[model samples]
Target: MSYFPAFLKLDNKKILIVGGGYIAYEKLEHLLDFSSNISIIALELSDNMKRVIEEKSLNFEKRGYQKGDIKDFAIVIVAVDDIPLQARIFAESKEYNCLCNSVDSVDYCDFIFPSYIKKGDLTIAVSTSGASPAVAKHLRKYLQELIPSSIGEFLQEMKELRKTLPKGKERMKMLDKKAHDYINTWSSK
Candidate 1:
């Protein structure tokens, strides 16, 4: 089955990563784009992982994952290569009311990470339901190039206008036209 696409606001959510290898590092990099409330528990951390942990001042445990390691997290990512370990963690995550994502293992994943492009407030996600991440990645890159770099600033202007304008259909129509015109102008250049 296909996965639903939605955007999550990670304002106060806590995330956990149960690995310290390169794959775990990749997950960490993606999570860091949206949140910093993350902790890791793994037997050994890669050098790059250790550096990022130190730089971000994130909590971590060098020991192997314990039974209750995921109890306080809202999302848990099992980046370890062991399928059994991922399965165990996925089951445990259910008891803790947390979402689990096991890297490269769709059977153990509550949700798959879609390749995305983020430009300030704009984020576009591309997914193939775990079929072809390479295609999704390349599509994301192509979409990114098509977007103007000043989109964030333009959105900020629209935000201010919305806040100042009174609520009505006129306001909605005006904003819609403004956005449509902006996109058309950018594409034309």
Candidate 2:
């Protein structure tokens, strides 16, 4: 089955992560790129995880996940190695109307994390549904290398122009041409 790729506005969204191991840490890193309203629960945290949590001062608990831990969350990420635990949390997520992502378990996922590149205001995502994340990651890396370093500045200039320009077909045409011309210059590099 194919999954749809969508960009969710995570502002004010509360996220719950149900582990503190390596996989959980990876998910945490990715989520950090967009939102900081995350809380983690684990029976025990790895030393590295502990350091990151302390540095960021994120809300966390050193205990087994409780039955109701997912109640107030907008999204739940089950990164524990235990399949049963992941399944249980995924089931619980439905009852709470929260999106759930069970690592390595496609059947229990409402969403899968895509390999992505975030440069300033630009975010490009590459996904292979549930098939192969490694391929997606490699593709994202290749795409990232091709994007020019001046892209962020160019995008910012476009933003200012959009705000200052009057609303009309002419303004739109000019902006479109400008964007096209900017992209055309990339091939020369």
How much does each candidate deviate from the true structure in C-alpha RMSD? 0.9, 0.8
Model 1 RMSD in angstroms: 0.9
* Minimal lDDT window, size 10, model 2: 43-52
Instruction: Work out how many backbone clashes candidate 2 has.
Output: 0
Tell me the tens digit of each residue's lDDT in model 2 across 91-114: 999999999999999989999999
Best by lDDT: 2
Candidate 2 segments whose C-alpha is farther than 4 A from its true place: none
Compared with the true structure, all predictions reach lDDT values of 0.93, 0.94
Output the worst ten-in-a-row residue range by lDDT, candidate 1.
116-125
Q: On residues 41-107, what C-alpha lDDT tens digit does candidate 1 reach at each position? A: 9999999999999999999988888888899899999999899999999999999999999999999
Stretches off by above 4 angstroms in model 1 are: none
TM-score per candidate, in order?
0.97, 0.97
Per-residue lDDT value at 15 in model 2: 98
Question: For candidate 1, what is the lDDT?
Answer: 0.93
